[model samples]
Target: MVVDDSAVVRGLIAKWLGDDPAVEVVATASNGEMALKNLAAADPEIVVLDIEMPVMDGLTALPKILEHSSEIQVLMSSTLTKRNAEISMRALSMGAADYVSKPESTREVTTSLSFQQELVGKVVNLAAARRLQKGGKVYKAGKSSSLNEDILPQVSSRGAIAKRKMSSTLPRIIGVGSSTGGPQALLKFLNSVKDELRLPILITQHMPPAFTNILAEHLARASGLPCKQAEDGDVIHTGHVYVAPGDYHMIVVNEGGKKIIRLNQDPPVNFCRPAVDPLFASLAGTFGSAVLGVILTGMGHDGLKGSQDIVDAGGTIIAQDEATSIVWGMPGAVSQAGLCSAVLPLDDIGAKVIDITTGEAL
Candidate 1:
C-alpha cells in the first residue's frame, strides 16, 4: 500500500514501484486514515508511508498499522529535511523496517532513476526477508537460555573461524556495522555495558547526514558514552563513539603517529556510502590484529569481504544471529562464509565484547 496526501507523489511512487516485476501495487490512499480503512482489503505486506498528510501523519499511523498486524513492514518516506530525517529515524526505532528520503518534486522523481530503483530494491529485499522469516526459529528477547536453546556456536565444516588463532594483543578499536534494526539493536547492545571497556568505537550505520547526527546523540544517551559524527581529520580517542556521516566513507590514516578519521565521497559499495566494507578495510589496515569487527542486522553482503580482512589480519569477527536481527543478510553472509569467530544473539554481543577485551578468546 502507498499512503500520501499528494496524488501526484503517490502516483509517481506507485508507478515507479509497480514497474518492478517483484512488487505489486495493492492499494493507494490519500491519508493514513484511508490506508487504515482499506488496509485489510489490500492485505499489503509492505507499506510505503509518507511522514506528513492532512488526515493522519505517518508517525501517528505507524503504531496503529503495526497493531493491525505484526507482519506488515512500514517504510517511512519523506522529503530531505532535518526534522523529517529525525522523524524517519524515530519511526525505524519504533518498529518500522526502514526509510527512504523522497524526492523534492515530481520533476525530480521523474528524473531520479536511482531513487526509483532504490525504492524497488528495498521493497523487494524486505519482502524476501519476510518470507524467509515465516515459520522459522523465532527467539524473542528475555527467553530462557536452556541448554538446548542457547549453546555456544561450534566450529562448522566451513572452518574459516578455526583457521585463525585469537589475537595476542587486545583489540584497540571496535568496528561495528549495522542497518535496518540497527538503531534499537545498537542502543540495547550499548546499554548492556557500563564503561568497562574503553576502546575507541567506530560505527557505520546506514543513515543520512542529519539523521546520523541525531543517531549519535541517541547513542550517547543510551550508553552514557561520548558519541559524535566523524569529521575529517578528527583524532580517534579512547571511550568515544565516532559514527560515519552519510554519503561519506570514513577511513583511518596514521598522521603524526596518531589515528584520525578521513571522509571521502567515493562511489558507494554494495549500494551504500559510508559502507561497512571501507571502514572495516581501514580498521584492518590501521589496527591490524587489534581490530574487532562486528556485523549486525542489515539487508545485504556489505561486510563479507571486509570481515575476511579483519580475520585475515589476525583480528576477530562477531555477528548477530538471525533470530535477533531484523534482516540478517550482513551477519548471515559473514557467518555462512565462516568469517565470524562467534555468532551470538544481539543481547549477548556487548557482554561478549567486554569479556573478549578482558582476555577471553573466541
Candidate 2:
C-alpha cells in the first residue's frame, strides 16, 4: 500500500513498485486517515507512507499502524529536509521499518532514478524479510553454533554462539556498521549496555547527511552519552560516539599517540559513502587484536571484506542474527563467511559486546 497526500506521488510510487514483477501494490490512499481505513482490507505487507499529510501525519499514524499489526512493515517517506530528517529518525525509533528521502521538486521527483531504485529496493527487501521472519522456525541446538546445520534461518538461541575463540585482550575501541533497520537497532543495542561501555565507539550507518545528523542526536539521547558526527582531526576518546558524516568515509589514524578521525570523499565503496569497509578495516589495522567489529542489519554485504580484515588481524566480530535483522544481508554475509566470533540477535548484541570487551567471553 502507498499513502500520501499527493495523488501524483502515490501514483508514481505505485507505478514504480508495480513495474517490478516481484511486487504488488495492494492499495493507495490520500492521507493517514484514509490509509488506516483501508489497512485491514489492503492487508499490505509493507506501507510506503509520506511524513506530512492533511489529516494525521506519518508520525501520528506510525504507532497506530504498528499497533494495528506489528508485523506490518512501514517505510516513512518525505523530502530530505532537516525537519523531515528528524521526524524520519523519530519514526524509526517508533517502529518504522525504514525511510526513504524524497526528491524536493516535482521535476526531480519524476526524473530521480535514485529515488525510484531506493524505494523499490527497500519495499522488496522488507517484504522478503517479513516473510522469512514470519515463517522461520527456531529449533534447539546442541552446544556449539559452529556445529548447527539449520540453514533456513537462525540455528539456535543465544547460548548457541559461534564457537570461535574471542580476543585475549580487551578491545580498545568499537566499530559498528549498519544500514536499513540500523537506527532502531542501534538504539536498542546501545541502550541495553550504555552504562557498561568501556571504550570509545565509532559508527558508520548508511544514511545521508541530514538523517545522519539526527541519528547522532538520537544516539546521544538513547545512550546518555556524547555522540557527534566525526570531524577530520578530531581525537576519539572513551565513552564518546563518533558517527561518520554523510558522503565521507571516516577512517581512524594514529597521530601523536592518539587515534584521530579522518574523512575522505573518495568514490563510494559498495555504493555507500562513509561505507563500513573503511571504518572496519582501519580499526582492524590500528587496534589489531584489540579491535571489536560489529556488523548489524543492512541491505548488502558492504562490511564483508572489512570484517575479514578484522578476523585476519585477530580481532573479534559479532554479527546480528538473521531472525532479528531487518534485511540480514550484511550480517548474514559475515556470518556465512565464518568471520564472526558470535552470531547474536539484536537484543543480545549489546550485552554480548560488553561481555567480550570485559573478558567474560574468555
Candidate 3:
C-alpha cells in the first residue's frame, strides 16, 4: 500500500514496489482516511505513507492504523523540509516503523536500473522486519523490538540514583541526534526526566521542513516542554528543546559566553540537512568540556564525527545500545570509535542524563 497526495509520487512508488517479484502493490490512497478505508479490501502487507494530506495526515492516521490492524507496518515518506522531519519523527512515535525522504524533484528521483533494484531491496528488507501487536494477535512484517524493563541497564529503580556531582562549575548543554526510531524514544526519554533538568537541550532529528512544526507540537504535548524548530539567531534556553529544521544545518555559536543558535543553508552534511555533525561540532567549539553529546537510534553515521569532536574537547558522549536501537549505525559508530562515555540502553539513558546533568536523581 502507498498513501500520498501527489499522483506523481504515488505512481513512482507504486512502480518501484511492483518491481519486487516477491511482493505485491495491493493498493494506493491520496489521504490517510482513504488509506484506512482501503485497509479492509487491500489487506496490504506493508504501507508506505506520506505526512501531508487532506482530511487526515500520516501522524494522526498512524495510531489509528495500529489500533485497527496491529499487524500493518507503515513506512512514512515526507518532503525534505524541517517541518516534515519533525512530523515524521512524531509518526514514528505513534508506531510507524520507518521512513524515507521523497526525492525533492523529478530530476533527483533515481531511475537508474541499479538504484531501482537497490531501492526495492531496501523496501523488501524493511517490510520483512516489521511487527506489531494488536488485539492480542501478534503480526510482524519485521522483527519485533523487545522493549522490556529487564533490558535496561543495571540501575536501581528506587527513584534516586547515587552519583558524584561534577567538580567543575562549567555550564553544560545536552545535544541529541537521532533518526529512524527517534521520535518514540525521544518522547519517552524527555518525558521521563524531571522538570528541573538544568541545561538547555538541542536536537537534530532527521526530517523535512513542514513536518517539523507538527513534530514540535507532538513533542511539546508529550514532554511538557517548549519544542520548536530552531530559527536563525535564536537564543538557546534551558527547559526547552530546539530541533533543527530539515534542509538546513543548525550550529551553536558563542557570543560573549552565551550560546546562540544559527541555521545554515549550506549544502547537506553527510547527505543530511540538519546533519548531526555541524551541531555537535558547534557544541565542541562553544561548550567544550561542558557538553554532553548523545547519539540515539538512527541509521548512518551522521553523528560520529561530531561525537569525536565532543570527546576531543574533553566533553562526555553517550550512545544507545544496539538492542534498543532500530538501526544501530549512528550509535554503533560512536561506540566503536571509543568516543562514548556510556553505552546504555534506551530506558537507562534518561536516568543517566538526570544523574549526570542535574547531579541528582529524578
Candidate 4:
C-alpha cells in the first residue's frame, strides 16, 4: 500500500513498485482515513506511508495502522528535514518498521536510481519478513535452535558459544554498528548500559547528515549521556558517546599518546561512507584486545570484514541474535563467519556487555 496526498507521487511509487514482479501494489490512498478504509480488502503486508498527509499524518496513523493489523509493517516516508527526522524516530519507537528520506520533489523520486533502489529494496525485505512471520518461521533471539536448518545452517545458539579465556585486560573502548532497525535497538542498548559504561562509545549508524545529527540528539536524551556527532579532531574521552557524522568515515587515530576522532570522506566502503568496517578496523589497531565490537540489526553485511579484523586483533565481538534483529544481515554475517564470542538477544546484550567489561564474564 502507498499513501500520499499527491496523486502523482502515489502513481510514481506504484509504478516503480509495479515494475518489481516480486511485489504487488495492493492499494493506494491519499489520506490515512482512506487507507484505513481499504485495509481489510488490500491486506497489505507492507505499507509505504507519507509523513505529511491530509486527514491524518503518518505519525498519527502509524499506531492505528499497527493496531488494525499487528502483522503489517509500516515504512514511513518523508522529505529530509530535522522535523521529519524527529517524527520518523518517534514513529520507529511507536512500532513503525523503518523510514526513508524521500527527495523533496515528488517528480524526481522515480527518476533517481538511489531513491528507487532504497524504496524497492526496503519494501521487498520487509514484505519477506512479514511472510516469514505468517508462515511461523520467523527468527527470534534465544530461540535460534528452532530456526529452519535449511535457511540458517550456519547459525548457532547461545549454548554453542565457543569456549575461550577472556583477556584479563578490560575493554577500554566500545564500538557499535547498526542499520535499518538501529534507532530503536540503539536506544534500548544505550539506556540499559549507560550507567555501567566505563569507556567512550563509538556508533556507526547508516544515516545522512541532518538525520545523524538528530539521531545523536535523540540518543543523548534517551540514554541521559553526552552523545554527539563525532568531530574531526575531538579527543576521545571516557563516558561519552560519539556517533559518526553522515557522508564521512569516522575512525580513531592515536596522536600525542591519546586517541582522537578522525572523519574522512575517502570513498565509501560496503556502499556506506559512515561504514562500520573503518571504525572497527581503526579500533582494532588502537585498542587491540581491549576493544569490544558489537554488530546489530542491519540490511547488509557491512560489518563482516571489520568484525574479522577485530577478532584477528584479539578483540571480543558480540552480535545481536537473528530473532531479535529487525533484519539479521550484518549480525548474521558475523555469526555465520564464526567470529562472535557471544550471539545474544537484544534484551540480554546490555547486561552481557556489562558482564564482559566488569570482568564477570567473557
The candidate that wins on TM-score is 2
Q: In model 1, what lDDT does residue 74 have?
A: 91
**Model 2 Cα RMSD, Å?**
6.6
lDDT of 1 by residue, 57-97 (tens): 99999999999998898988888787888788778878788
Clashing residue pairs for model 1? none
TM-scores for every predicted model: 0.84, 0.88, 0.69, 0.87
- Model 3, span 12-70: residue lDDT tens: 77887775554679999999999999898999867888888889988888888778786
- Rank list by lDDT: 2, 4, 1, 3
User: For candidate 4, lDDT tens digit of each residue in 219-272?
Assistant: 999889999989999999999999999999999999999999999999989878
Estimate the overall C-alpha local distance difference test score of candidate 2. Answer: 0.84
Please report, in order, the local distance difference test score of every candidate based on alpha carbons.
0.81, 0.84, 0.73, 0.83
Q: Which residue pairs show backbone clashes in model 2?
A: none
Higher lDDT: candidate 2 or 3?
2
What's the CA RMSD for each of the models? Answer: 7.8, 6.6, 8.4, 5.5
For candidate 2, the per-residue lDDT at 76 reads 95
For candidate 3, give the lDDT of residue 192: 68
What TM-score does candidate 3 reach? Answer: 0.69
